[model samples]
Target: MADYNRWMNERLYDAAATLPEAALFEDRGAFFGSLFATLGHIVAADLIWLNRFVQLPALAELRGPLSALPAPTGLRDRVADSLPMLRERRVQTDVVICDMVRRLEPVHFDEVVRYGNTAGASQAKRFGPLLQHFFNHQTHHRGQASTLLFQAGVDVGVTDLNALIPHEA
Candidate 1:
């Protein structure tokens, strides 16, 4: 799972890195404005989920959708601006999840986690399924962002989960 996460992150970064400032801002009809806003949404969602997993104060207000579109930044700018925060938060989230999994002698797969639904309705749901959805949600949106970037003439690198290796060679 760690390898999968790391790989997905790298592929996401690689795809993001290839996007030119011009293409990044070009409206591809993606939510937010262009590829840039979509990417921003992905980053924002990841941050929110990680914050909850790590028990950190919510960094930004929990909103259903992005409001002010984030401007396109260069590859370097994105690396400098978002990667560090995302990576750090990801590590913290992974650690907490691993610890929780370790502590659970046997978890009930059917057990649900209660939370406020998007419609502001109260709900209870299974845990493992929700976790799966959380990760899958990232992949789904990132895939859209990647496609938008490609349409805009950028090349996001290999996206397979099996392709990501640890940072250490």
Candidate 2:
């Protein structure tokens, strides 16, 4: 799932890069309003989850570095206003995610974590399923971005996870 997340994000960013600046940030009335917002939301949400995941003792080393940037205040925050900056942030976030997953021990998944939602509600859940939600959330918004891009006449090409599967005899 981490690999899929990275792969799809790279594809989306690549496709979005071809568009002129205005089209990228135009409000099309989708959930996040535009391609830029959709991607920004993904990065923001990923940081939220990464911050949660790093709470586990095994991942504590990542906590400080991930804290370097001010945590996003809300999912709707326009975290990055430009393609270049957003793309850079997206890559950096993906690197942190991939590294965090690599260092995770199987036991880490079973541990429960507590976090505050954007709405200020308290919540607790197992780390494993939250990780699933993390990646799935990315796929969901990326799908929206793809549709919006297509509406704007840009194609992200084939996006199936099967494309990454190895062929075997």
Give the top-scoring candidate (TM-score): 2
Provide TM-scores for the models. 0.60, 0.95
Model 1 worst lDDT window (10 residues) = 63-72
Ten consecutive residues with minimal summed lDDT in candidate 2? 69-78
lDDT (Cα, tens digit) per residue for candidate 1, span 97-134: 44444443235445656655445667676656766776
| Model 2 lDDT per residue over 14-107, tens place | 9999999999889999998888888898898888778877888888998877886547868876667799999888888888888888998889
CA RMSD of all predictions: 8.5, 1.1
